[model samples]
Target: MHQQSAGQLPAEVLAAFQDEQQQLDAAGIPAGVATVGSVMPDGDLLDAHGEPTTLTAARNGRPAVVVFYRGAWCPYCNIALRAYQEQLQPALATRGVALVAISPQTPDGSLTMQQTKELTFTVLSDAGNQIARRLGILTAPTEPVRQAQAALGLDLTTVNADHTPALPMPAVALVDTAGVLRWIDVHPNYATRTEPAAVLAALTTLD
Candidate 1:
């Protein structure tokens, strides 16, 4: 196993998910790689409409930004998405960087979101939490959320359009043209996330 260090995340995130299982217990917040390394078996995911869009297709020989969010139901997720749509996209494009927002939301849901948020970049769906699971960041929801989701008909599997019934990490990863990770921002609290200005700063490292 790699000797994971705190530098993969900020001090706050490090405190949240030091051990793998501790991250699983944290509600709202999803834990991911607090330490960075080359991705494994990276591949495509179904878009909001259920079309497969691969990671290789998305992050080709160009600097790219990938943002992962819970479904659109989360208010904080909405804030982060809108912030990227309205502010982060333009700022990053200026630096020749591409931005993509990924979620397990269904294609119809993603379309509605695109219209609602006026997002201009690619929005891929990791239905079944396939992408998250492959990345080793998918988490099972706490019982309370499972019950609430069932009551509200917010089944993530349906939202994802697949069999994956788990939650995913709330984070953003920056990769340069060569598909190398330069920075990753993760939050343990679902109510919070990395800000747009900080995301832009990360893009600067690609320069």
Candidate 2:
């Protein structure tokens, strides 16, 4: 799917994304960020039903695999979510782990995406990116990338719940029942995602 996008995208737009990737490389990961063995951060988020919740609630006393995505407006995010549902969710279920997807979109948007994608797992809205910020994975689009997205008719401010135009790097983190992170995958490239096979492998180690 990403190959198809790269092939169809205009040179200017592709260049803009490349420039943003370079900038992100220069910025480096945030300092003092949570790593393996650290407890997952807590935040008040909204479920697809618009009810207040937390990651732990989504886990429901089970281990969890949390996915951080950009938003419903992103094609890449849609593809990733669907793939996870079709390929990963069953494996996670066998392990007694819940799969939860998080985004900065509002609860309404989350509901729309969950229904449109026919997802069976939990989908939550991380308003203001409270949890992502605490995890040190939030990133604001570069000016060039933002301009390119605007040109493509995607206004981040309108899609994001916080209206900050920021997104979390697409990430997959495995949290134990105790809320300690056991494994994590943070992808700097928005065009890519953590593969389901890799997530399954991570889950095996937890058992």
Candidate 3:
């Protein structure tokens, strides 16, 4: 993705992203973040139609793979989600595991992503980063990156439901039928993602 973007995006924009990646790598995952065996927190979320929902409702008594992304405006996020829709959803469905994608973006953004990606899995709006905060996966673009985003005509304050630049670090959590988190992977850098194959392998370790 970086290789392709290098040919298309401005040099300053690329530099800003690279700088953020370096900073994130240096900081690493924050302390006290939720870990395996933790009970996943339930929180209010919005469906594609702006209707109220929750993680529990989305799971519907089935084990679930919960994905937290930055927003629909992120190309990296769109790529990962589209891949999950194509590669992960079908395999997970066979195992009776629900696949859900959540972001701090508005319901409108969620709807657009779902339709544009033709994603059959549940896409939700995590207003105010409720679940992400509890899971300790939340982060925000740096000032330099935010400026770069504005240059590209993207204003996260308006794109996100929380009206802030805050976003959840791209992360995935595997929760069991009883709502207990079995495995999790958090990426401090927004450019990277957890592969479906890794998640499938993690599932094998569960009961």
Candidate 4:
């Protein structure tokens, strides 16, 4: 996926991105990450309009496929989200499941991502990645990668709601109406994501 834009990036920036991917692959999923049967944590979030909301509110008593992505500035995130909107959303709707995508980006950024992707599902802003932290899916770019991102005109400080470089490892969690996590897939490597098919298959296991 990075190859698509590699030609456009400086050599050093591309190398930095590769190094980050290697480190993530070696580290694997973080220890103590939320597992199936655990209660999914609810946290304060901002809707695309910047209105206060919560994970439970967005779920509205329905089973939900909760997505945690880096932000609108991430090309891989955009691709994954667009795929979810097109493929996963309709399938989830048929099963009475809600699809919600959360990011640490500001409300405006969330709004832009939804608008740009023409997404119909709920998009929320986790001001400080409160839910992500509790789920143990938190990650941040390495220093070299951060510098590379800056070279590409991406600034996490201004792009993120918390004004920090923190981000969630791209993840998908299936939560039943009871707030129990049915399944979870975490990708420490930012370039990879939970495929729509994988998420739908997991939904079949939910009671």
Candidate 5:
């Protein structure tokens, strides 16, 4: 899932990318999110409509598949999201499970994403990365990456709800009906995502 944009990068630009990946690798996975049986943390976020929503309310005795993505500007995120909507969402629906996607983007960005992708499930704006911070999956972009983003006209400050230059590692959590986390997958590489088939198999185990 390497970025198509990366194919045309010059030598210096590729060096910068390598440097950024090194920084991210050094940061590693957060200890808090490493456990499997932990309870999913509750947090307040805004839906695409700007209405306040909570994780607990969404769970409500039903299993849930919570996905954390970078944002709408990311092509990889878009591909993964569409895959979830077309494949995983339908399977989850049959089992009475809810599928939700969260990002640091503002409500407007979330709305744009929902409309652009024609996603029927919930898309929430996790302003200030409150949920990611709580889950210990929060990460800030390296300076080189930030420079690259700015050069590419991707001003995350304008798109993000809090104007913070941070993002969560792409992740998925499968929560049981009781709200306990049954499965978790966090990808350090933004280009990678949890496969819909893998998620479906995990959900099957919760039965």
Candidate 6:
């Protein structure tokens, strides 16, 4: 079942996200997310409130530290998201950076995620995996992984309601004020994520 707010996050789902959180080891800047995207893609995702928002509009006049997650259904993605909520935003803002999160879930699911994680930044909804594929980070889950997720009680049936069943590979990108890509970070495994400390350092380097 799909939820419209985070408060409705089933205990099992919350626990799953948290467990995925524990698997992270503060990945360094050069490890996984080092592959730079050739060009930044233009796309829009609805905010948690179900309002349409363009990526360009969200990055207005400031650099943006963007993180793309699968959806509320994924445990590992949420763990990475929680890390951003707790550490990345403040550090990035001090440097005139905006924090934006993208997901292929609907607006209702996005809201559920925000409430579930107490996220402080923008959570944009990309109902179709359109934007995700554009950045070259989206991928379909393996059959085994899908089966495991289903057995674990995750309901992906509705998360990817738009068509393609795709998710971002726990990726992060630092975009400059001019909306150009300064750096890109992505992990092949869903269980790992970018370290906030490393991201802070990378943001400074972009200066």
Which candidate leads the pack in TM-score? Answer: 4
Question: In candidate 1, which residue pairs get closer than 3 Å at backbone N, Cα or C atoms, i.e. clash?
Answer: 29-188, 44-54, 48-107, 49-107
Q: Where is model 4 poorest over a 10-residue stretch in terms of lDDT?
A: 108-117
| Candidate order by decreasing TM-score | 4, 3, 2, 5, 6, 1
In candidate 5 the C-alpha lDDT for residue 44 amounts to 82
lDDT of 6 by residue, 82-191 (tens): 77877877777677789998888877775463555687788788777666676667666655445556666655655664755676667788887676777877775566
RMSD to the true structure for each prediction, in A, is: 9.2, 2.0, 1.3, 1.2, 2.2, 6.7
The local distance difference test score of each candidate is 0.66, 0.86, 0.89, 0.91, 0.81, 0.69
Q: How big is the positional error of residue 157 in model 1, measured in Å on the Cα after superposition?
A: 3.0
Global fold similarity of model 5 (TM-score): 0.89
TM-score of each: 0.76, 0.91, 0.96, 0.97, 0.89, 0.77
* Model 2, residue 151: C-alpha shift (Å): 0.9
Candidate 1, residues 99-195, lDDT tens digits: the string is 8777777767754645455777777776666656666566656555555556655676666556566666787888777777788876655556788
Cα deviation of 134, candidate 1, in Å = 3.5
Candidate 3 per-residue lDDT, tens place, 1-207, comes to 988989989999989989999999999988968988889987989988899999999999999999999887888888898889888999999999999999999888765535555889898999999999999988889999999999999999999898999899999999999999999999998889999899888888566
Model 5 CA deviation exceeding 4 Å by range: 1-3, 8-11, 22-27, 111-117
Candidate 4 backbone collisions, by pair: none
C-alpha lDDT of candidate 2 relative to the true structure: 0.86
Model 6 residue 37 distance off true place after TM-score fit, in angstroms: 8.0
With a 3 Å backbone cut-off (N, CA, C), the pairs that clash in candidate 2 are none
Q: How accurate is candidate 6 locally (lDDT)?
A: 0.69
Q: In model 3, which residue pairs have backbone atoms overlapping below 3 Å?
A: none
Model 2 spans with C-alpha error above 4 angstroms: 25-31, 111-117
How much is the lDDT of residue 176 in candidate 4? Answer: 95
